[model samples]
Target: MPVTSVTTDTEALTLTVVADFPVPVERLWGAFADPRKLERFWGPPGYPATFDRYELRPGGIAHYWMTSPEGERFYGRWDFSEIEEPDRIVVLDSFADAEGEIDTSVPSGRMTLLFESTATGSRLTAVSESPTLEALEQVLAMGQAEGMREAFGQLDVVLAELREYALGKGTVTEVLDDTHVRITRAFEAPRHLLWRAHTEPELMRKWLLGPGGWEMTACENDFVVGGSYRNAWAPVGDTVGEPFGFDGENLVIDPERRIVTTERMTGAPFPANVNDLSFDEDGGITLLTLIISFPDVAQRDMVLATGMTTGMEASYQRLESEILASV
Candidate 1:
């Protein structure tokens, strides 16, 4: 079986897996709604699953154990907070002790699972939220995103075996400027809405920064050409920590049209890192184009080496959630 391809925001540690299966919406919902069916394909590939208790209702809890091929065992639990039947499942997932108690010391997050019926089939989206950006980074480093992707790939196979499954198809494409990678995704929301989420401090704090152990420190944006913007991120941990900061030079700010900014590492000040965001409306849906340009090929390589893709993906997911909530 081919491993399901996964994408992550290198900075935010967000993971997104998109796959289209041949199963109908109702059948797909059945697989997700029925605990018995869920256990059959919930764990990563090659990991056997056993459920201790499963109550799929609002405020219910699902506790299960997964044993790897090497005979290693681990426990995980999901506390369901909201269940919208065939549409959405909202829960808080975490590592748990044998007694099914959440391990508070470990990082965990709230996840919202969305199922949208499409012309071909159902479009399923799972978005997980962490308390802090560092928490997101930690989980990504632990291979959570890849593990989830593998598990979803397993689901694809299980669904296929049950019938003729049509695998979800998508591409991993990037927009670049000879050096840096800039990924772009357009949604049906207005440009002003998107801009508010990107610029407003209160709105930015929610999905822009990670968990508790971090602070924005400082953020200033002129929102005009020849103006400047600075965003500072600092670790909230006690011991020595690394601080990440970005300073930008605004080249364009066309409300409802586009905003272009050139960013650079605050203290280090590498060459220019440009981001151009444009918006267009099609019927009732809005299109957002994000173009990020780096100084040179070497700088682009350096940025990639930092693993920004997964973090950025997570940031985008958070942004999506905020956007949906606002609308």
Candidate 2:
């Protein structure tokens, strides 16, 4: 993680966060100056932010919202008070409603962001000052520190151009928290086609086979909200593994944009895990992000230890070569 420290001073009614990045001060500053790049990592792993309005000049206002896994949106606004090129930015931050109306029920704070050159690259110091110590404590109790850590962890991909950073990196997995794991992979294909490859049974049978010597025997997909899907695989002639399958229900679906499902081994006794998958396309390439929420930390670790990452990479490679190539 880029964030090195997060400190809170009750007497001073301030919270400070310091993060170091391997990019220059200007480049790091551009991440915030540009709304597109800023939204890419503005929220934590599962929640994604969308900037509806962004004006960086002094006295301007920026409105944004982060959509939760269950489709709930939380709105926020920033009132710019000062800006000093690549060095400093001061804003008043507060909660807002869907219509961008300030929510007075929540405490607002003054935030100052400082950018400076570091030995390695650049450092960002963000300080948030509350009107009262109680307000500072309230914000900390809402997981502000941990949320910033997770949000900063996503900056590397944003700082580096998406394609330049992600393309050809078969499958990368990061443990966001004890129960949440995020997996990402980039494909040289359009977003809609990639969505079809995952939803259509015939197309899925061609590449969803995790490893060699196995064939997808049965694929039944309802492909709708509240729909259930079942997939089974059996080893071919010389394969050593036994037959296994999985069943899942679709919790949310948004065509080529997102899909949330609860999956579990067909007959296993363990609880089902929620898989939140999202797709982003740029310049003919699509980036697939899947965030899995396990029932507990034990379940998350156990699944990861089963060579899931390697298997997924193999499957993705097959997907690109077999299903996507002929399309």
Candidate 3:
């Protein structure tokens, strides 16, 4: 759900990032206010960050080091300039060394995080400004964009678990019928935004990968009655194997209301699958009811036996952090 978008303005020497989250302004603010939580997703997926200093106001400094999978560590620090509660924060960011000294020889950027309250959730836009065009290019060349994207996806997972724990509600899953698999989950985001998350291919791709190390390389959705769609995904690392694929036909589409679709794993051993999804909105939350069907009870049980619910639940939980939450 760490779906982050970065736009570089060459003329202005800034890297602008915009993201959405389905939580209250204060909750989202906590991610930065708490050093422990910030380290959870501050670095890229394979690199876990450790913090030494934590500060939340002007003239304060925050320092951290990100350890790579191979045990190599990289340091970074931020000097806060301004802090507006549940609103915005501005800071000067720079690279650092093992001793926690800022690397002035390297590029430095001024970063700003802007927050806004929405009908269903909150929006955050981050701007990183480099002193020169060359410095901006240096940061981009260092894979900042891709790193931020991956880091945010991991952030999505963390936010969901944190919310559940804070609310004293463990993620609950229920089976409504034998042939019909029903899953109900509530989101802080509005119904319309949640509907777009289900319908839009770009948005859907972010949270569709149920677990880590899997990437949706291809997602093509026609988004209309009788239209066909295809999704392809596979192990992200050096796994030498062809990706798996799923192609389906849209049986019905009623924008923000309902959708029925038929799905089949390209080379799977089971029969095709059918699904009916309904969206209901009350107050500011959207309740998604998913009912899946199979050819028969045997096939339905077989699908369940394959441990589908666990992955589906993970995906839905991540969806809460991805959808309009990251818009």
By lDDT, the best candidate is 2
Q: Mind giving the per-residue lDDT tens digits that candidate 3 earns over 209-278? A: 8666788888998877778999998988875556888888987665675677888988887788777676
Compared with the true structure, all predictions reach lDDT values of 0.67, 0.89, 0.75
- Model 2: per-residue Cα lDDT over 1-327, one tens digit each: 788998888888988889899889999999999887788788887777889899999999999998777667889999999999999999999989988888998899999999999999999998989998888888889887777777877887777666787898789999878999989999988999999998888898999999899999999978888889999999999999989999999877767778888899989999999999988776677889999999899999999999999999999999988888888
Residue 204 lDDT in candidate 3 = 79
Q: Which residues of candidate 2, in runs, are more than 4 Å off?
A: 162-164, 190-193, 280-285
What is the RMSD of candidate 3?
Answer: 17.5
Q: How do the predictions measure up, each by TM-score?
A: 0.47, 0.88, 0.51
The TM-score of candidate 1 is 0.47
Q: After superposition, how far is residue 180 of candidate 1 from its true place, in Å?
A: 34
Which stretch of 10 consecutive residues in model 1 shows the poorest summed lDDT?
Answer: 162-171
Output the lDDT of residue 151, model 3: 70
* lDDT tens readout by residue for model 1, 28-134: 77777766567656876435466778888998998987754334568888999998878888889898988899988778888888777778766667777777888
**Candidate 1, lDDT over the whole model:** 0.67
Q: Which predicted model would earn the best TM-score?
A: 2
| Per-candidate alpha-carbon RMSD to the true structure | 22.1, 2.5, 17.5
